[model samples]
Target: MSGIYIHIPFCKQACHYCDFHFSTSMKKKEEMVLAIAKEIQMRKSEFKNEIVETIYFGGGTPSVLTSAEINFLIAEVYKYYSVSDNPEITLEANPDDLSSERIIELSKSKINRLSIGIQSFFEDDLQLMNRAHNSAEARKCLEVATQYFDNISLDLIYGIPDSSQNGEQAQQMSNEKWKQNIETALSFGIPHISSYALTVEPKTALNKLIQTGKIAAPKDDVAQEHFAILIEMLEANDFIHYELSNFGKENYFSKNNSAYWLGKKYIGIGPSAHSYDGVSRSWNVSNNALYLKSIQEGKIPNEIEILSVMDRYNEYVMTGLRTIWGVSLDKIESEFGSGYLEYLNNQSRKFLDDDLLFIENGILKPTKKGKFLTDGIASDLFILN
Candidate 1:
């Protein structure tokens, strides 16, 4: 009802740090697109009575798809479901795939928002991560994209491995270099930015590279330092830290993701995408071959999980703590009962006393100093799933 997330599972090349589900081969791309449209129609009954407010295109690289293909899937959504009058439709795209011609063509489509993946403007960072785009392509894409799109968001990766001198893992990124990265992004005058640290997940190319001494690992301390600088710089430029990893100017917050943080129901279509209702969660199979096979047979290959009370409580505490809208005490007591609220209060006592968490009015929120540690604190306050 609130949103629909369509996962495009094809990419031109692999990024070392990415762990999302995708495939490099485009042999089945056409079939995949048809299957996605079919799935969208199949799930229409789920939201028959609800108006869809947002539709997000996220994936291996949504930009890899042609404008016609993208529009076809969007057409399927409109045919099957009741969409909002002015829905927020977002497409997640990579820099290399967003050529000058491509950007102009996309501007004519129904998509109203663009989430560009411009991880960094430096050659070292791009090459180290094996990004398909060069630094020039990143800058060029934004220059063209900004001219046609008013609603745009940039993705920046901080705390990238910085050991060019000798490849030492503990060595931190130069403070000035990190500052420059932030400054370069600000020059574009974009409305929103979603930044994150470069984490090393096991079995990924980045992880393997680090294990074989091909690249240095990202340091937590460096990430914290970069995060601090990011907050200071973005806030000074009139951006609000609405969520831990998201910053937006006035009237520019992401409607799709906001719904998720607020625990609203939405459906995910395509291979490896997830869906959620108020009481249960579901996900399509991650394997593209299997997903296509089942969809062609008129069945959605998905697994469902019914959430228990404790499971719901823990999820609430986790998501609620990460955003500007803190957890509501009254809602907790009324919805989850007094026992869970009491347990939360007891578990959060240490955090509240230490200034890591605070109670303002009736909501519990993290302090500036404690913002980065919100996840850990939230986990400690969980009701036990």
Candidate 2:
């Protein structure tokens, strides 16, 4: 089944390291939501069968929308698409927006999953990232949220301002202390977790701070070490490291994202979101005013690209290598012809010999060592022709 993604391009405040297309000014909230609903209605035929299996509310912060706004948006989705009986509808929320009343409202709505952005449990780290929530609110929201939903996921930021990871005056948190954060969520029976290192993206406020010597740059070694610890700790807690940055226990994998990884078709609504079918990819313009005005004029301000054979091969190599499923030689042979399959087999030989990759049941899977360097290896194996 296909999926749908809606982008809410407004945030209460900007996180220093974020580079997402969002505006802190939410004067256009009502207009934006209406436009998104209209966009979905206009593009209803994009996916032949409206039997959608997943719907994702991602954004500047989906939580920024009021409960009434969320209800209206979801109603529009139901009107436009034929939702699955058991659809996985997820909303990306921040800690500050989640209260007992809001959580109860969300539980009663069609939304079945909550992906909370509780980036750090430390007040200082929250301050460093310009996160709007404090340590107490971060801890409290989870308590309020869990009382309503069982299939919950949370985000955690690692390699932040900490003496443990080597910040000048930051308190040293023990590895056990790091696990404490994970354990707290797991205790709530959280089914999924997405954690990432604090990356200083170019032109971001965090990058500017590092340049001005106001904040330190993240250490790669320290980030890697933290990642290792995170993996070990979560695995011990029975969470499956399904994707590089995502972990899930039992059957709680993100269906919307899993569809993307498996190369399934999906449509995206609103500004700055991407849409992909097997053969082509497209994205809406990131500007809110322009996006709404164009859509109102019966135009989709977007660009599309039809994938070439080489492009498809490269994409397969890139996405396939990131997952536990790896690249299947049989899949390549069937889809791209035997010549391309032979080329891949020959190219992967070096990695196989180095113990970075292994051929298991004709599928090339990455070793623990290979996972860290997947991007480089995927590039090396790309069919440029």
Which candidate wins on TM-score?
A: 1
Off by over 4 Å in 2: 163-177
lDDT of 2 by residue, 1-385 (tens): 7899999999999999999999999899999998998898889888656489999999999999988898898888888778889999999999899877888888999899999999878777788889988988878888888788888899987876553334344443345656767777677777899998788899799998778666667776766677788888889989998887889988998888888888888998999999988899999999999999998998988999999888888888888888777788999989988988989989999999999888888888778877767878988999876
Question: What is the TM-score of each predicted model, taking all chains together?
Answer: 0.98, 0.95
| lDDT (CA) per prediction | 0.92, 0.85
Q: Per-residue lDDT for 72 in model 2? A: 92
Q: Report the Cα RMSD per candidate.
A: 1.1, 2.1
* Best candidate, lDDT: 1
Candidate 2 local Cα displacement, residue 180, angstroms: 3.4
Q: What is the lDDT of residue 64 in candidate 1?
A: 93
lDDT of 2 at 46: 84
Candidate 2 local Cα displacement, residue 335, angstroms: 0.7
lDDT of 1 by residue, 186-266 (tens): 998999999998989886999998897878778888899899999999999999999999999999999999999999999
C-alpha lDDT (0 to 100) for residue 237 of candidate 2: 85
Question: What local lDDT does model 1 show for residue 100?
Answer: 92
